[model samples]
Target: MNEANNHVFDTTTGEEQHLSKRNGSSNGTSKNGVANKIPSISEIKAAIPNHCFKSTIKQSMYYVFKDIILIIALYCFGHWVLQCNSIILKTALSPVYWFLQGTLLFAVFVLGHDCNHGSFSSYALLNDCLGTVLHSFVMTPYYPWKISHRHHHNNTGNMDKDEIFYPIRKKDNNKNSFALFFGLGFGWLAYLWRGFGPRQMNHWIPRHAIFAKHVVGCILSIGVVGIWVGILGYYVQLMGMVSLVYHYMIPVFICGCYIVMVTFLHHSDINLPWYSDDNWDSVKGKLSSVDRDYGIFHDVIHTIGTHQVHHLFPIIPHYNLREATTHFRKAFPQLVHINDKSIFPAFTEMFFKYSSQCIVENDAKIHYYK
Candidate 1:
C-alpha cells in the first residue's frame, strides 16, 4: 500500500482512520493498510506563516477601543433601566439588558485574557497595563491570573498535572455521580473562592501583590461602588446590586461553565490520547489537546476555538489563530475536530462523556477505559 493509504479503517463507516498504537505511535497500518503521520506541534507551528506569529500595536489598540465601546454601551443600558420604574417594564427589560451586559463583560474577559498572553499588544508593558485595569474592573487580579494561566498553557493536556481542569482518574473518581452536577452549578464560585481568592495576593508574580501598589486600585473600585450607592440611596444600590448579580455575576458563572465544559470535552474525548510521565513532553502534551470550531461565536468573542494553534504559538494574537489553524488542518487531516455542536451534546452526556479519561498509555496502548 502507498504510505498515505497504510493506516487502518472501519469498513462499516467507510472512512480512513488510525487506531492508537500499543506503543503510543500512529505508525501502524489501517484496516485498509494505509500509513499516517501525526505531525508534532513544532512541525505545525513551523508550517504556519511568519505573520501569524506576530502581534501588532494596531491590533491591541483596536481591542482596547472595542472594550471601551462595550463598557459605554452597557452603562447606557443600565442607566436606561434605572430610570424606568414600572414593574412590568423592569421585569421584561431586565433580562434583555443583563444579557447584553453579560456579553460585554465576557468581551472584557477575553480582552484581558489576550493581554495576559501578551497577544493584545506589541508592547508587553502596554498589555500588562491594560490587562490589569480590565481584569480589576471585572474583579479578577490580573497578575495572579496571568501567572496561573501561563502554567495552564505550559501543561495543556498532561493527565497528571495540567494546572487547571485536570481530569479525575479511576482511583480518584470517588465523588458520587451527583457531585458533578452540583459542582458544575457552583463551579465558578468554587474556582474563584477556593483556587484563586485566597491566593490572589500571595503568588510570587508582582501583579498578584494586591496589598502592595494594587491596594489603591481595590480601594478605588470600592469607592466607585460606594459613590454609586450614595448617589442613588440604599434602595437604588440594592436594585443595582441585584442587576449586577443577575447580569454580571450570574452570566460570568455561565461563561465559566462554558469555558470549563469546553476545555473538559476537548481533552476528555474518547479518541484523544493523554500522556503519562514516561512519554510526556511539551509538544506531545499540547498536541494531545484538541481544537473546536465554535462557529460565529469565534468572531464575536475572538477565535479562542483555534486552541491548538494558541497552545503551539501562544504569542500569536487571537486575530491570527484561524490562519495558523488552517495551516495545520491541511497538513494533518486525521487531527480531531471538536466543533461547537459537539460541546452542548457532550455536556448533556456529562459523566458518560469524560469521567475517567487519562492522558498517557498503559502497556504501550492508549488507555481509554481509565
Candidate 2:
C-alpha cells in the first residue's frame, strides 16, 4: 500500500485526514490486512480533469445513433440468413448472431445506465426519455429499476441496505446456491418483479414500499414497459413464433446473462468487504467495487468494466471514464482495485465459490467473503 497517499474522509467536517495522523501506525493496515483508510469522494474527483465531467447531447447521441445503425444492419443480415437453404449453415451461424446481437443490446443498457445517472445529457427530461426507451427495449422497467438502482449506488456494500449483489449473511441458510445459479439469466427480472436483499417491495407495483417515494416515475416506466410488451406481441404475431425466438427471445436472454454477470462480478469478489451501517459511508461503499478487464468486449459494452471510477464519479461520461481512471490510479494507486483475471476462468472460479465466499458473519461490524 502507498502509505503516503493513504487517507480517510472526515464525513462530518468534509475534510481529508491522513490515516497516519490518527494513529501511531505508519501504514493504514487493519489487523485483518484490509486498508483502514479510504480516499474521500472529493479527493478522488479533484484528481480527474474537469472536462471528463462534462456531458454534451450531441456526443451522447452519436453513440446512440451508432448503436441503432449497427443493430439494424445486424438485423438485416440475420434476416437474410433466415432465407438460406442450408440447415447446417444456419446452425453454425445462429450462435454468432445471438452473441453479437445480445452484446450490442447490453451495450444499449449501459447507455441507459448513463441516462439514469444523468450523465448521458444535461437535460432531465431527455435523460428520462432515453432511459425509458433503452430499458424497455431490453425488457426492463425504466424508472422503477432506476429508483432501485439509485438505492443500490447509495448503499453499495452496506450489509443491511444494498439492493443487489448483497453478501449473504452467515446466519442465513445455504439455499442461495440455486438462486445464484438462476440469477445469471433472470436475476434482473426477478429483482424488478420482487425486491432483493432487505427490501421486499415489488418494483412493478407502484404502491410497493420501494417505490413509495417515486410512485409517479414508477407508474410511468411501468406503462412504457407495458406498451413495449404490446409491440413485442404484435411483432410475434406478424413474424411468427420462430422468428421471434430467433431474433428477440434468445438475444434478450443473452443480454440478461451479461447484465447479471457483470453486476455480480463488480460486487461479489471473495476479498471485498461489506460493512454494517455503523462503519459504512458513501466513500467506503464506492471503493468496495472492483474493476475487471473484459478484453475486447470492454469497449463493446462502453467501458463499464472500468467500474471503480464510475462508482466514485458517475457524472464522468462513459467515453471519458478511461482517462478519469488513469488519473484516479495515479492519484491513489493503492485505493483502486483492479481484477486482472481472465473473464471465463474468473467467473467459473467465483461461481463454485460463491455460496462459501458470499456468506459473512452476521454480527461483525465489517464482513468479508470467507
Candidate 3:
C-alpha cells in the first residue's frame, strides 16, 4: 500500500495531471487494494495548495452581492412578464420566470451552503448571517441544517455515523423503496421537516447547544418568510390558486427536487461504498462520493458540481472549487470520479443502481452500489 508515488493519467487524452499514480481501474477504485486502503483524506488535503484553504471577505462579498442582485433582477423581470398585455402571452411566458427565478434561488442556496461550510468568507459571523438568510429564503431551517450537515461531512462514508444519504441495509427491504425513488426530489423538504430522508437525521442527534444560538436567527428568518408568503398570498388572491401553483410552487418544487437529487447522486453513484467501522476512514469516506458537471449552468450555480473536492475540503470556497477539483483529480487521478457522459444520463444509471444494487448484506465486510 505504499502507493505514494503512483501516477494516474487521464484515460482519454492520456494527459498527465502531474499527480499520483492511479490505484485501480478506469473507474477510480483500486482492484488490488481493499475498500479501506486508499490514501488518507489528510494526504489529499495536503496535496492541495494552502491558499485553497483561505478565504477573503471582499471576494465573498462580491459573490454575495452578485447573487443577490441577480435574484432581484430575475424577480423584477418575472413581475414584468406577469404584467404582459396579452393574457395568452402572459400565461405562456410565466413558467419561464419560475424556472429561472427558482434556479437563482437555488444559486443563492449554494452560496448559503458555502457559508454553512465556513468557506464563503473569512468572517464567521458574516458567513453565518448570509447562510441563514439564503437558506431561509429556500425554506431551510439554517442552523439546524448547518449543524446536521457538519455531522454529514464529519462522517461521510460511515453508514451508521453518516447523518443523511446512507443506503438501506440489504435485509431491511420494505415496500417503500419504489415510493422513495419516485419521491426522491422532495428529499430535502423531508430531510428538514419530517426526518424522513437521510434517516430523519435530526431526530437521532439533536445538537441542542448548537441550535440555541441560531434560534433567534431561525425565528427571524421565519418572519421574513412569513412576509414573503404574505406577498405570495396577495398574488394568490389576484392570480388564483391554480396560477400561483403553476408559477410559484412548481418552479420551487423543481429546484428543490434538483438540489436533493444532485446531493443524492454525489454520494450514491455507481461503485461507491459505505463502510463498516473496520473498513472506514477519512479517505474512503471522501472517495465514497463523486463529482458532476452541470454543463452551462455549472458556473452560475457555483462549482458545487465539483463536489468531491468540496467534501474533502469543505473550507475551500465555491469560487475555488473548480481549481481545487482539478488539482485533486490530477493528484489523486485514481481516486477522482467524474461523469463525462452527461449529468442526467449518469444520474439515471446511478440512481437505478442506488435503488436496486446498493442494499448492504448483513454479513458482508464492505457494501457498495451494485
Candidate 4:
C-alpha cells in the first residue's frame, strides 16, 4: 500500500471469507490460500476528501450554540407550560419535553465527543476547555471519558481490550438482563461509577487501571463533575426538588437512555465480527461498527450513528460525516454496512437478538454475536 498524509501505510491483507479456516500463524494475512484485499485505515483515511477533515471553530461553535439554544428554549417553554395547572396537559407534555430536551443534551454530548477527538478545534487547549464544559454539563467526566474512549476507539472490536460494551461471556447468565435493564436505565452513570470488562474500573478514581496514566487529568475531570453536581444541588435548593426532577433529572435520564441505546446498537450487531487480539487489526476492528440511520433525529443528535467512518477516522468532524461517509462507501462499497431500520425497532431487535450471545469462547479467534 502507498503511504499517505499522516503515516506510512503497510500493505496489509484483510479478513478472509472463512476466517476460521485460516491458521493464526500470520498477522493481518490470511493463511487459508484465499486472496482477501482490504484497505488499511490509513488507506481509507486517504480516500476521504481533505475538506472533510476541516473543522472550523465557527462551524463547530455554531452547533454547540444551536444545541444550547434549543435546550434553553425548551426548558423555558416547559417552565411556562408547567404553570397552566392542568394535570392532564402537564402529564401529556412532560414526556415530550423530556424526550426533546434529552435528545438535544445528547447532541451536546456529541459535540463534546468531537472536542475530545480534537476535531472541535485546532487548538488542543480549546478542545479540552470546551470538551470539559460541554461534557460536564451533561454530567460526564470529560478527561476520564476521553481517556477510556480513546481506548474504545483504538480497540473497538477486540474482545480482549475494548473498554465499553465488551461482549459478555455465555456462561455469565443474567448479565444480558442486567445490561438491558440497568444499561438502558442508568448505564452511563453505572459506567462512570464502575466501568465494564474484567477490570471493572471506576472512571472517577484517579488510581484506577486505565486512569493511573493520567491521574491529574482524571482528578480534574472529577472536580469538574463535582462542580456540576454542586450547581445542580444549588438549583434544587432554589427551584425545589419536584421542579428539579421534572426539569433536569428526567431529561438527563432520557439522554442516558439514548446514550446506551445508540452505543449498544453501534457495536453489538448480529452480523458484526469480534476478533481476538491476535486477529484484530485497525481496519477489521473499525469495520466491526454498524452505520445506522436515525431519520429525523439524525441531525438532531449529530449523525453519531454514522459510526463506521467515525471509528475509522475519529478526527473527522460530526458535521462532515455524511460527506465523508459518501466518499467512504464509494471507495470501499463492500466494507460499508448501513442499518436503515427505524431507531426503536432496530434497537429492540438487536437488543434481544444479541443480548444472550454477545459472549464468545475464550479461545475463539473470531466471533460474531448470534
Candidate 5:
C-alpha cells in the first residue's frame, strides 16, 4: 500500500466521465408489446457461430499472463510514484496511481468471472485453480458465487426466479429504499458482507451455525484471503498502517466498488426488460443486458463492457468478446442493445430507474423498469 495516498471514493456523485457515447438502443415499450413469440434457447445459440464457443489453453494462458503482468506493473508504478520527495507531487500523482491500480484489478475480476463460467480455459482444473487464485486476491468466494451466478443465468428475466434484481409490482417496490440503489456504485461492499445482486444467498454473510450450501468452500476462500491479508500485515508492520491503507486497502476496496458499478450499469437500467412465464425468451433474456463503454479502461477491464454478447454466450473468452460481439450484432441487430454513452447518462438512467421507476406496473406485460 502507498502511504502517500489515503481515502475512499465518493460514488454518490458517481463516475460520469467513465461512460462512453453509444449509437443505438433496444426500445420495446409495453404499449408496443414484445415479440409475438419468444425464441427458443437452441435458436439463440444457433445465431452465434460455433467458433465463438471454443477455448484453448494457450490463448487463455496468454490473457492470464497479460492481466497478471499488468496488475503487477501498476502496483510497481504506484510504489515508485509514492517515493517522490515533494508533497505536492505525492498528493497529486498518488491518487492517479491508486485509481489505475484499482482499475487494473477490475480487469482481474473479469478473468475470475471467465473462470467462474469455465470460459477462461479448456481444462476444468486449470480454471478452478486460476479462479481460486484470482478470486482470493479480491476476496470473493469462488464456489458460492459460481453456483448462485448459475441461478442468475438459468432464470434471467423471470420476475420470480431471477436471484437478484428481481422486480416486484410497482406497488410492491420499496420506494423509500435508499440502500437498494446505493449499490449502483458502492454496492460491492454491502454485497461482500450482506449478499446482494443475483446471488442465491439472502444474506451476504452466511450463518455458520446452520447448514450453509458452500460452507467448506466459503471457509476455504476466507482462509485463502486471510493469507493475502497476512501479506498486507507484513507491509503494515514494515511501513506502519498508513502505507498499507493507501497503497492496498483503500485502492482494493475501490476495485471491488468498480466491479459492482460495472455489473450494476449493465443489468440495472431503464430500457432493459424482465419477463415472466410465456413472456420470457432465452434470446430476449440475454439481450436484456446493456453494454456500455468505459473509454480507455475498456481494455484495462478486459472488455467486460461487451456484456450483452457475453451473456448470450458465456463460453466466449474475455479476450475474444469484442470480436464476438461484432458478429453478434451483425447476426441479430434487433436483439442487440448498446449504450456506449458516458457514465453521466448511465447515472441518470440508474437514478431514474431506482428513484421514480421503482417497480413494474400493469404498464408492460413484459415487466420492464418503469
Candidate 6:
C-alpha cells in the first residue's frame, strides 16, 4: 500500500471514512465533530485481493443458466394457472403467480442492466444481443435505455443533469411537491406517452426517432397478445387483461415506487453531501453514493446493497460487489447502511426528509439540507 493507505479510518460511530489527496479534502467531520479521513482509490483497491476483480468465464455462464431456469419456471407456472377452467382456482393462484412472474421480470431487468455494463458476458456483442432480447420482452427500448442509463451513472448525484431521478433543490421544492402527488397516481402513463408527445421533440429525445427501432418490437409484442386473444376468446382475453392488470401492471407500479423511494432515500440523506461541478471529481462522485442493508432481498436480487461499489465500478459483476464492498468498508467506515429497520422508517421519513431538500455548501463544508 502507498502512503495514501495510511489515511483510512473508522469513525467512532462505526461509519467508514476514506480520505484521498486527489479530492483535496483531508478529512470529513462527523456530526459529533470528530474528523475522519477518507481512503485513496489505490488503498481501496489494495485492500481487496487481485482475484476479486477478475471475472471468470465460468461465473458468467452460471448466471445465464440460472436466469434461463428461473424464467422457464415462472412462465410454465403462469401458463398452468391461466389454462385452468375453474375460476376459484385461477383466482386463488393469481396473486402467487403474478408475484412469481414479477420476480422473473426483475431478474430480466437485472440481466439487461448487467449486459448494458458488459458484465453479463465476456463478449460485448453477446452481451448486447442478450440484453436487447431481455429488455424488449419487458417493453423497454434497449439502446435508448442503455444510453440514458450511462448518463445516469456518469452524473449520479448532480442536481441538474443526472439523467433521471435527480432530487429537487430548495428553490425547486414547491414545483416538485405538486409533481410528486401527480406522479404517484399516473407517472408511468406519462412516461410512456411522453415518447409520442411534443416533449420528445426536445433535446433529450429526438422528434422523428421517437421509438424508431423499438417500433417493430412494440408492434410485435402487441401482435403476440392479439394472437393470444384470438385463441382464448373475449372472456379469456378479459381474464388475461385482468391478470396483466393485477400481476404485471400493479407490481411494476410497486417496483417503480420502490425504485424512486429507495433512490431518494439513498442519496438524499441529511448527512450525505452533493457537489457542484467544480467540487466534484470521479472519486468524490463515487463517494456521493450511499450503501443500504437490504436484508435477504440483497442476496436474491443480487448485491444491490453494495451500491457504492456498483457506482465505483459499474462494469463489475453483481457477484463481486459484496467482496468489493467489504474491502471498501475496511477503508472507509462512514459508508451508510440502510437496512429493513432503516427502510421501514423511511416511509414516513421520506415525506418530511426529501420534500424540500437540496445540495448546499457552507463554510467550505458540503451538506444536504432543506
Per-candidate local distance difference test: 0.57, 0.78, 0.68, 0.77, 0.66, 0.55
Best by TM-score: 2
lDDT per residue for candidate 2 within 276-300, as digits (tens), equals 8888999988888778889998998
Residue 342 lDDT in model 4? 76
Question: Residues 282-337, candidate 3, lDDT per residue (tens digit)?
Answer: 76786667677788878878877888888888999988887787778657666755
State the lDDT of candidate 6 residue by residue for 156-197, as single tens digits.
Answer: 665544544444444433332425522641543344335211
Candidate 2, residue 342: the lDDT equals: 80
- Error at 95, model 1, angstroms: 2.8
Regions more than 4 Å wrong, model 1: 1-40, 82-89, 170-185, 196-240, 340-342, 350-352, 356-370
lDDT of 1 at 219: 48
- Listed per candidate, the RMSD to the true structure in angstroms reads 7.0, 6.0, 4.8, 7.1, 9.2, 7.0
Task: State, as a TM-score between 0 and 1, how close model 1 is to the true structure.
Answer: 0.72
Clashes of each: 15, 0, 8, 0, 12, 13
Q: Model 1: per-residue lDDT, tens digit, 1-370?
A: 3345333322212234443331222433232212234566667767789998888888767876886787687667766875787888878987777655555566677788898898887887788778777765555566656766776677766555565545445454444443463265265445544442112333322343333554554444345444543544554466667655654566566556555665565555444555554556776666555566555555666766667667777888888988877776555544533333455665555445454432223333233322
Q: By how many angstroms RMSD does model 2 differ from the true structure?
A: 6.0
Please report how far candidate 1 places residue 280 from its true position, in Å: 1.8
Candidate 4 lDDT for residue 343: 78
TM agreement with the true structure for every prediction: 0.72, 0.89, 0.81, 0.87, 0.82, 0.70
Question: Which model is ahead, 3 or 5, in terms of lDDT?
Answer: 3
Q: Weakest 10 consecutive residues, lDDT, candidate 6?
A: 195-204
Write candidate 5's Cα lDDT for 1-370 as tens digits.
1221111111222111111222222222222223334457576667666778888888877777887787778777777777778899888988888888787677777788899898987888788778878877776766566666766777776675565656656654544465644654356656656554323353235563232676776666667777877887887889889777777776777787687677667776654677765677567677677777889888878888888778878888877788787766554444555665587567666756755554667444565554
